[model samples]
Target: MLMIFGTWASQVMSRTLHEASIAEKYEQWMAQYGRTYEDNAEKERRFMIFKDNLEFIENFNNAGNQSHKLGINKFADLTMEEFKATHTGYKSTQPKSSKTVSPFRYNDTEDVPSSLNWIDEGAVTDVKDQRQCGKGITILSFVSSYY
Candidate 1:
């Protein structure tokens, strides 16, 4: 009975350590990619959701008889409904143009001009942090227009 209790305790400790290591790795990845949350509670919630989705995707990918391809991406914190609503909302509201015009064609083989500095030409912009209010779209649009 003592040996059994010792083995169980060891297993529990090992699992706890493994989970801690996984959480550490996740935090590191988030920091490297400049991800942040409003507060500790939000961060913990998102991390839990990310872990569950990652495990599900890994299992699906490893299944022998699976036909559909399953992969993990940065949007694991978002649910399917939220993702669809955000991305697909524009599709239904697209305005139709009555004029039929020839599409402009570009020559892919042509080299870019040697004197072109993309940064100066307004191709790149500075990053701005939008805290709490979720006004990222408005900020980005204003910045792009100003540049």
Candidate 2:
């Protein structure tokens, strides 16, 4: 009976210490990402998302079978829906048109290369760092015509 009690007490203490360490990690992540909430409720909500994301990151990395791995970033505190809605703006409501378009450039499959290196072609823009500003990836599309 004494051994049983001792085991239970040790288990409880271990769990408490593990939880404390997790909470400390959350605090450090929040500080790094400059995350803040208006109230305790909001903080708790974000913390749940953050914890879920951390678990996913860990599991993905531990698998060790993939060419790439996931990591916690500035968007770690957000849910998938929240991140998409906020960062990936302009979801088209219109139905897809059954349109066939002809390519202006790279028209000939035989002439075209298998893959493109836009950087080598000097078509790519300079890399932008949004450190502390915390901006999401944005793509711009433009249609050109001779005026």
- Which candidate number maximizes lDDT? 2
lDDT of 2 by residue, 7-88 (tens): 9999999999977887888999999988889999999888888888888999999999999999888899989878876766
Best by TM-score: 2
**Candidate 2 wrongly placed segments (more than 4 Å):** 1-3, 90-147
Against the reference, the lDDT scores of all candidates come to: 0.70, 0.79
Cα-based TM-score, every candidate: 0.52, 0.59
- Superpose all Cα atoms of candidate 2 onto the true structure and report the RMSD in Å to 1 decimal: 9.3
TM-score of 1: 0.52
lDDT of 1 by residue, 1-147 (tens): 999999999999999998897698678768766789999999998888878877788788888688787765566776666676675443544466977876657535465554644456788755567563343455443322211
Lowest lDDT 10-residue stretch of candidate 1: 138-147
User: Residue 54 lDDT in model 1?
Assistant: 73
Clashing pairs in 2: none
